[model samples]
Target: MTATSSPPAAASRLDHLGLLYRDAEEYAERCAAFLADGLAAGDPALVAVPGANGDLIRDRLGTGRAEVRFADMAVAGRNPGRIIPGVLLAFAAAHPGRRVRIIGEPIWPGRTGLEYPACAMHEALINVALARHDAIVLCPYDAARLPSDMVEDAWRTHPVMLDGAGRRASPAYGDPVATAADFDVPLPLPPAGAARLVFEGFPDLPGVRAFVAGWADAAGLPSVRRPDVLLAVNELATNTADYTGGPGTLLLWREDAVMVCQIDDQGHLDDPLAGRVPPADSVGRGRGVLVVNELADLVRIHRRPGGTSIRLHFDLGIPPPS
Candidate 1:
């Protein structure tokens, strides 16, 4: 299928497209067509997919494919929560005024059950996050490899659907905020040997970091990853202190092959897109959550009427470099 030659009429709106392809060959062909259209239109373009897919597209695009910024989604989008700020919005924000086109494949056959909810939410929230941007984002789904339900969810998340048959508006499109709210399952309790801490005030930031590092070390988290875990914890704790004006509780534990950290505060995060999009200015409040999402292998948030709880996960098997 060929992509539209030009971006949609509304320069301030986001046009989210979902593509369902049956195989590698089909994916490569459709993606190449879509991205080629974007490149030919002189729009800033980006492709963030798994390494093999990136290679396939590059091979098809041939020389000068290097001009298209390419990122390995396996690494950049390891935590789906980070895709909006670290990948999508980062690209759009860099090229203000000009329309941008991106091919992002965040969901794949390899996504674990634990990671699916966050991935789904990320997909849904993309609509809300980029609502006012002049961007066209194409998200690809491996139809033969992924579950039917996942494909259905894609229809709900995206406003436009593209396949071999071409593009059309998705009748299944729903409010992204409501879609995100549907996945707000309660997080599990910390493990048996979990460590707990409570801190208040900006002065306690250091204490929070220290506490996280200490527990990370005890949990056998590699030295290299300890810093990331600490930074994520510090970001969460800082948000708690700054926004809630009260003490926040933190729990750390090693469950199976993952190290988990949960931060709780008396604050409700109403914006589903908070950490997913970068702040327009340096002083933006959601930057901390953005940092936390980037550092953690997986991050889950539960925000209710009374409070918010964010859980950060680091895989024990993926040790940091020496």
Candidate 2:
């Protein structure tokens, strides 16, 4: 999770935005018109709308670029993380050095900050994707619903514009989403072996840890990093069960520089950022996310129509199997 709040890295080549929309239809129509211009201008683009809003984008653009309905995002597709960012990354890759634009809503035009973490995740994923591309990226959203803090943060780095009605605004820029298509976070050589652990919902924590530790040992990984991995997964998996209930699946694998752990549950989160969110809790939930934020190098979350999924990527700097 490379939030806007995170300490500055080598200065990402990304842009942020804050839009104000009067209505969903107006928003969709104007977005379609803007994208049409962008396409004609020779930039590449990807469009995302609530499942129901696909028609709006399609009707306006008439199909030249790759488009994905937000409905396809599901817990089953957790291997590469949530569908939104993955689709955005894929679209950006297809264009290669061209601009990419993603529309935030489709079903019903709405306010951003009012929706919870999905909008935030939407922005964060786009930021990660835009880190180094020469392409332009655009996002249209309702400003009234957004928190002032988020709006301020997004406006700080991009060209924001107010819409036709005094009620709408958006960011216009050339930061493309293609940057992350080739994103490779460097890590140590992967374990000598790899295996997949499948489970239905959340298993008993102790049992899950034992399984993971045993598998890691067999994979020729160092024992020293085991507890960190084990505890992190346990706390997160437990958190998953507590929030999303007990009926889902989890997958583990290694790709490039990361040892990936993903958990899926049949929970269609209405609010996107509910899981990794900061909560003011004496019950420890807020603290748990804080810990996950501190320990994991990268954390991505997405929700499918039937459920929600979370993926955590751990860096490989620790010793080999101890």
Candidate 3:
């Protein structure tokens, strides 16, 4: 996409733009120009993209990079669920009432099949999350590398599309809420050899920790990360007991080089955006899910009328078999 001019100021407070670019040079040039214009207009700016692309944009910005907040999307946004609360909204909240410019590339070519659904959900939710906010978030996609369906999703999620063809309204844009609901379908069943643990209440919490630690060791999760995994499960399990009235199931397995921990409770998650935003009260049940999103590498949720299943994915630091 060419950065010839900014989106019109009257086009909603949250000017979410979808940029489909051909290659690295195109990505860097347009993104740098977007940030530069924001900076020149005295808008607080942020750039969160993958490492190599971020370096390219940083180099293109020259000395202007000093005034912007930069984050490694690969790390800060490992779980697409966390990008809104931990990155985008957090940046906007820091500077109240002021218009902000952000270039956020949440979906890229290398995203795994298991993670793509969450990324799409994230893209759709961005519309709802920033509907009334004074922020211009530019999201980029690699039209040259990503699959056709993924590119199609860019159209479904963003109301405006910007490419070499120029900016225009997306005729394919669907209601963001409906799109998010469609993606909230059930996750696939775990493999036959996966391990399972059942807990009744707070009394069984210790056993839950032991169960996670054993699998973390077998999955070769490093010692430092073991605590995070444990904390995530503990919080989820606690929520089960506190909110769902006990008797939750925990499933653990390793899919190639990634460790998976899924928690299933017999109650529904009434709030669709429970974990996507930070809780106003520290002691709220929403905090548990928020913590899990922040701690896990990837988080996928399947919530239905009778039950809710949340899966957390963590890399084992081992190469997958060829």
Candidate 4:
């Protein structure tokens, strides 16, 4: 009965729910109950999870149910950096006055090794991002699939935990800013074969795009994906050329099934949620970062005392024989 009970609406501005499950049945029962509680309270609900999990939740909610919003996190949140701005905050902003409920499954066994750290950072940052918002966000973790350490990290990031037994406060909860700050992993070095280009002014943007196109073709990137990579690179390079008031360096290389592009500049990306959120305009401002996130298969940013380095990944299958 406790599992089905709804927590007080005004109990907290942001309720971070960490759902730990061992099997599919357990996940379904708990998640369904949570959504049902939200619906009964007249709160708008959003469920963003992987494809299969979304199907399970939708099935539980029944057919022709129009109250709930659903999105495939695998596509919407492919870059964990974008989840906070693009998915969670966007939904919460759309429904202004009333409390909103979100079921977000960002971390799963399917995440790549390079993506796990960013995913973990995103989890930690959520606590800070939504601390003042009227929202209840449930972040589910598959204990059976993920490492024990990651499960432990979840406890530190989330303020509450929910399961078959019921909900409870997480004793391991800590300052989210501090927790996220600890996850500043350095960007990996580009391959030796990486081609480098330097651009000094906005006038150089066209040249930057041209450089990216040439490298993209040599890397065997499919024509379909080349445009995305070029756009991403152009956006980052433009940010450097315009904002930093100095030359920016662009690097390109191929590393097994993927094309890697990195842009370095003296500018600092102060806002962690910059590119993740959609911008109002197309040129200048944070729109470039948003475009980069939307285009790149994976994006990694390293900000140090000196400058910022952003690496963009594009998945390109093996090249055809010459």
lDDT of each: 0.84, 0.50, 0.86, 0.81
Per-residue CA lDDT of candidate 3, range 138-253, in tens?
99999999999999999999999999999999998887877877788779889988999999788999999998888777667777778788999999998888777658999998
Tens-digit per-residue lDDT, 90-128, candidate 2: 565667765565554311224322232333444544554
Clash pairs detected, candidate 3: none
Compose the digit string of candidate 4's lDDT tens values, residues 1-322. 0001122344358888899998888787778888999999999999999889987887777743478999999988988888888898889889998899999999998798899878888898887677657999998899998999889989888989876577999999887766776676897778786899988888888898888887766656788887788778877887887678568889888777778889888887776556654545563356787778778878888776778888888877665445
Better of 1 and 4 by lDDT: 1
Q: Which candidate has the top score in lDDT?
A: 3
Full-model lDDT, candidate 4: 0.81
**Model 1 C-alpha lDDT per residue in residues 1-322, reported as the tens digit of each score:** 0011222245438899999999888888888888889878999999999879999998888756877999999999999998998899889889999999999999999998778999999998888778778899999999998999999999999989998788999999887778877877787777766788989889989888888877766667778787788888888888888888578889987767778889888887876676776656765456788788989999999875678889999887864433
Residue 233 C-alpha lDDT in model 4: 83
Best-fitting candidate, scored by TM-score:
3
Model 3, residue 32: distance off in Å is 1.8
What order do candidates take by TM-score, descending? 3, 1, 4, 2
